[model samples]
Target: MEWFLFQLFRTELIHREHPSSPMRSTAQQTSSEIFLAAVKRGAKRRARLSQKILAAGKIFSTPIASGNGEYLIDLSFGSPPQKASAIVDTGSDLIWVQCLPCQSCYTAIRAKFDPTKSSSYAAGLPYQSCNTSCQYNYMYGDDSSTSGALSFDSITIRTSTITNVAFGCGHRNLGTFAGAGGLMGLGQGPLSLISQAGAITSKIFSYCLVPLGINKTSPMYIGDSAAAGSDIAYTPLLNNIVNPSFYYVGLTGISVAGKAVNYPAGTFSIDTSGQGGFILDSGTTLTYLNTAAFTAVVAREAPRRPTLPWCFISLVWISPSLPLPPENIFVAVDTLGSDCLAMAASTGFSILGNIQQQNHWIVHGIVNKQVGFKTENIETI
Candidate 1:
């Protein structure tokens, strides 16, 4: 069945599984409902990686670290393009950030939230009517319980500084993410930046991420969308439960420890918002691979797991990849040499999350109605 990308309501959501690592600190929030309403349904096909490492004329964002161990994005909102520091999350849909006169502020960062700041900042920008079934609330179970407000405004990127595009400042914001100011929701919605840009007739997309442990040349961009161009190739968007149309990047390849694997890591991906422990995230601190895949890695490194009864699960790298991994679940990555897909899941196997995605630039692109990926700058690659 082809997953379709339609309007998003509050009733669709899914829970994420925990990681393989036993002792780690992560967020307390967990989603249990499955979200497939907005999935872009299509058949999967094979594709090659783009020869270019980085796409030309790319669109990106400048992500800042929050006390919550997550990255905060500078979402464009309000009049004259006031950039607010919000979390660039794919897990949820309500993209909200702290309003003017925040309770606290970033040390080196500044938010220009002036109610009277610009000609575009009109008092009471008016709420949008949910005509397309695009109602959203920020509650845990697919119900946009948070029920953020919809204030219309103009937003510009720091690069070209384009003026006056249809953007929104979330109605409500929570300072939960490690001293985070707010959030920039990246899910499929009318509120997403994707639906805001007036410049392109076709759909435009952008991502702002900082490679973990790499701290130089963190840049963001606008227009000249990489996902829309061919310089960066892509495969078809999946219609599965695990990898919704959340922009999965096809991997040209992946390596375990210090050696490059022969087969490429096919497109089974998603851009999770901010994951602490037992969650998915951008720039997640570690790489969490499938137990079989990860155990193969561990055996290569430590040879064998601790001689405990359930210390480590024995796994083999599944040569043939699946179009979709699974649904309503996430896999956890235990240490390299651990046992039985060490998941906190009392039910099924481990669901893959961020632990398997550390130290990599997972990219996204669209070509001939498809998306793809290619990992770069590794000891093995």
Candidate 2:
């Protein structure tokens, strides 16, 4: 049987042994928790970016803190193939998993990668060298870091076994990543999976993350399967000369309740200096805007005193008492203590996070240098 190399969904915590698990009753509240965590994580990422801008005069890819990205993918590694779950992040490079002989590592939900058990383990690939024994130390904005040996081994995703896959075998790992074992680099970097497997993926990838709480599965597609239909809205992908590893998108403006909130032109533009502009980060749970842009958006959205509807069990109903616009289901104020739209008070750049990207077919077209978005339903996807 040929395992088609397409469509991996978010890993559910309740049922790890079964592939099909029904969305739990507390899914809506769980979604809110995830969103709030993403907001906090995004702020940390912004701080790190600001520091890089001030010190190095250029930006670089940084590992997102835990609770930022919500997408979870499952794959296997080594000769016998140890199954593991990883956070899918488009902002950071370096696909890594906790390895054996851990010096200081967080507890993983699954078994750690053991190179000795793998027959195809190689001493080196391009970035991960086994011969000379390369080491990678990646520090996050939150002060958490991962240090490990860089090496090569075969990785299996579905039916496809990608050979000579370069990845980090983390021995010293710490942070708030509670359930996930490691990270899968979907970013636009040399060490990222997309770049490493460019010959097979053809520089294309797409994903439709099913809204949190929904029982449906979200699928990630690579290569020709990532193409979008004509109805999808497209924007050109901007180049960040300072950090070529990130996927920058041109964000003209934002609309609330069908009204355009005006901000200065080039508020989200990236000039030759490699500053400003927005990124489409699957790892970030909430959308983030620069101070000026965020303030303007909040002013426009705060005035609406509408009631938001929520679903309980399998039924959806309107909650007239809730003080939020129907369109902004994820928005919260004061009592709920979560931002319907998060603000980036710490950084100059804006981010189009995954919260705003829910129930949408998001495409990353490297060859075309464009990103496309199309509204979708979880059931249909």
Candidate 3:
């Protein structure tokens, strides 16, 4: 579980790769075409996730907005290290992969992971209710699901290997996974990779998200190596009893171009029932604000022409303020330089998404109950 660095690629870019080539070519499409396509897909993903958050209320369940992840990583599982790709998701818990003997599976997957081929694979757990093997079933909001035996095995990322890792060997997987082998859950839950390997990771990790259009892989650091440096800015990490897996933050206020936007108090606060709050999620592509706050921000910033090169939107997190440049707040809609707001209004809760996180070294300091941020040129890492 020693801290290690691994490459993270956009899912769309990976899909565009030719079966015989490792190079992730865009199939000759222009950068604008790829960016616009990603934006449209992100809009669909946002709508699905918003629906689940609004309807779930206090009822908690592992919900995967499958096939819509913005980023993915390549890793290996079991002995001999059979290569596999998984979606890196901070919104849900439970690491899983499609196993052999799949009753129903997505045809897009290159190959099914056969647990029997690995010598280190083990089934069942002490807490499992089954007499012989542990069984797991996860249902998503979009009617996608994976169900199979709960087991443990060796997982390798780069040169770092961790043994006896808990994961679900999915025998029945049905969904639009977009050719991914499975999902790597980075949430704050017992089944998440971070929690399962907490002894080594110290429940801490950090990542630098690159833009979707960029073909270069981004870097992800885990364990002690992810510790924030002196230049990092820290903010309180709130806990939600209703949904403990999510990483919640304190969003106090917002300002556009140094001008404060008037919004009602507690607009971003998690209520006693855990109804509304602000969360930082890597799986979500675009940022989402609560209806009231979203309206205020749009009304304040919308008057400016979209062609402007500068739009500094600062998000006040308790005592610290994180300013987002125009590139992070606005997305290109056409080659003519017309841009659109890269955020949406949410009826349930607000989320700081990946688009708003590019080029920033974000550290999730779980043990200390605080998240840290440091601006850096991630491509140089």
Candidate 4:
């Protein structure tokens, strides 16, 4: 078993010649403009995901890929360890990478993984011991798809090496990955990297997201290092049988300032049909609340800052009262010259996105089925 720490960088920083360069865009734009654009894009993508989940009435076991997510991590695969950059997605399962003999792949990818080059590469699961290769086809909600063989190899994260890791060797992949080779799925699913490497990771992981535009790499801890500190708050993770991959929390209600926003008893709960619930998603940039809840919260917070239409206060989650400061709740829109709420309204499902998670040391205690949070300056950590 191995445990170590690694760096988590935002995908937008990949092509930047300098820290201030525009993210995911060819045109010159200010940092504020880039921030606004990314937030809007994430909100739209999240809406689509919510709809897809509701339409299917369950979280897809195959998992949907969010193209060019906000954060990514560098990983090394194979025996000697071939380097590759992959999106870090807590919303999806299945760690995969673009492999050689590609039917279709992103032209921007500088290096395509050649499994044959690795001495440790194996065709399928070790338990299977079958002569035939295990094939997989993953279709995302946004039409992006990847078809590959279920393969085994060594994956290196920082200095720690985890052997016999299961990952997809994507022969055919189609998506706007922004040069990323593939995705590292951290979702609570059987096929997720955490689950596959449970023996070494101890089914524990934690990450502290740096504030946007900080030009700093965040820290992700695995195994014993990921345990919650004394100052952290613990919340039981709700189980959604239909959508078991997602991390659902017990959200009683939200409060603006000291006042609690009015909403129904089970507004944030997953119904018998698994329709509506609140999930913590690392892939989504902005937080989303159920329409009714959103309206109530906004109505209370927006009135405080009449001059700044978009300005809103922090959200205090009841029961445990996890407070998110204004810095984590708002995004500066350069054009408007005012901060906008980094939140949106969803029809049913709600998400606690990355923006709201900034500077928070979030621990996912998989074995205990709990999540812990503590405020900390991520850059220092």
Could you give me the TM-score of model 1 versus the true structure? 0.49
What's the lDDT for candidate 2? Answer: 0.64
Query: Per-residue lDDT tens digits of candidate 2, residues 1-381?
Result: 232444332222221112342211234445555445556656665566555433334345644433334566778888778888776777777898888888998876788887888898765555433466888888766777788988898788766676778899989998745457788888788888887767766677877766544565567777763354456666677788776768887666565555666777767777666667777777665566777767776677576635324311010011111112243235554455544544344256766666566667777878777777776756765
Error of 4 at 119 (Å): 0.5
lDDT of 3 by residue, 21-125 (tens): 232343776666666666666667666666655555545563654344767777889898888878777877889988888888886445778888999998887
Once model 2 is optimally superposed onto the true structure by TM-score, how far is the C-alpha of residue 351 displaced, in angstroms? Answer: 0.5
Clashes of 1: 55
What does the lDDT read for residue 107 in candidate 3? 61
| Count of clashes, each model | 55, 3, 0, 0
Model 1 residue 123 lDDT?
Answer: 33
Q: What is the lDDT of every predicted structure here?
A: 0.32, 0.64, 0.76, 0.74
lDDT of 3: 0.76
- If both were scored by lDDT, which would come out higher, candidate 2 or candidate 4? 4
Question: What TM-score should be assigned to candidate 3?
Answer: 0.89
Off by over 4 Å in 4: 1-26, 57-65, 126-131, 225-229, 306-319
TM-score of each: 0.49, 0.79, 0.89, 0.88
lDDT of 3 at 154: 92
Which of the two candidates, 2 or 4, achieves a greater TM-score against the reference? 4
lDDT of 4 by residue, 34-95 (tens): 67767766876686576556765544353463556777777789978898878777888889
Residue 41 displacement (Å), model 3:
3.2
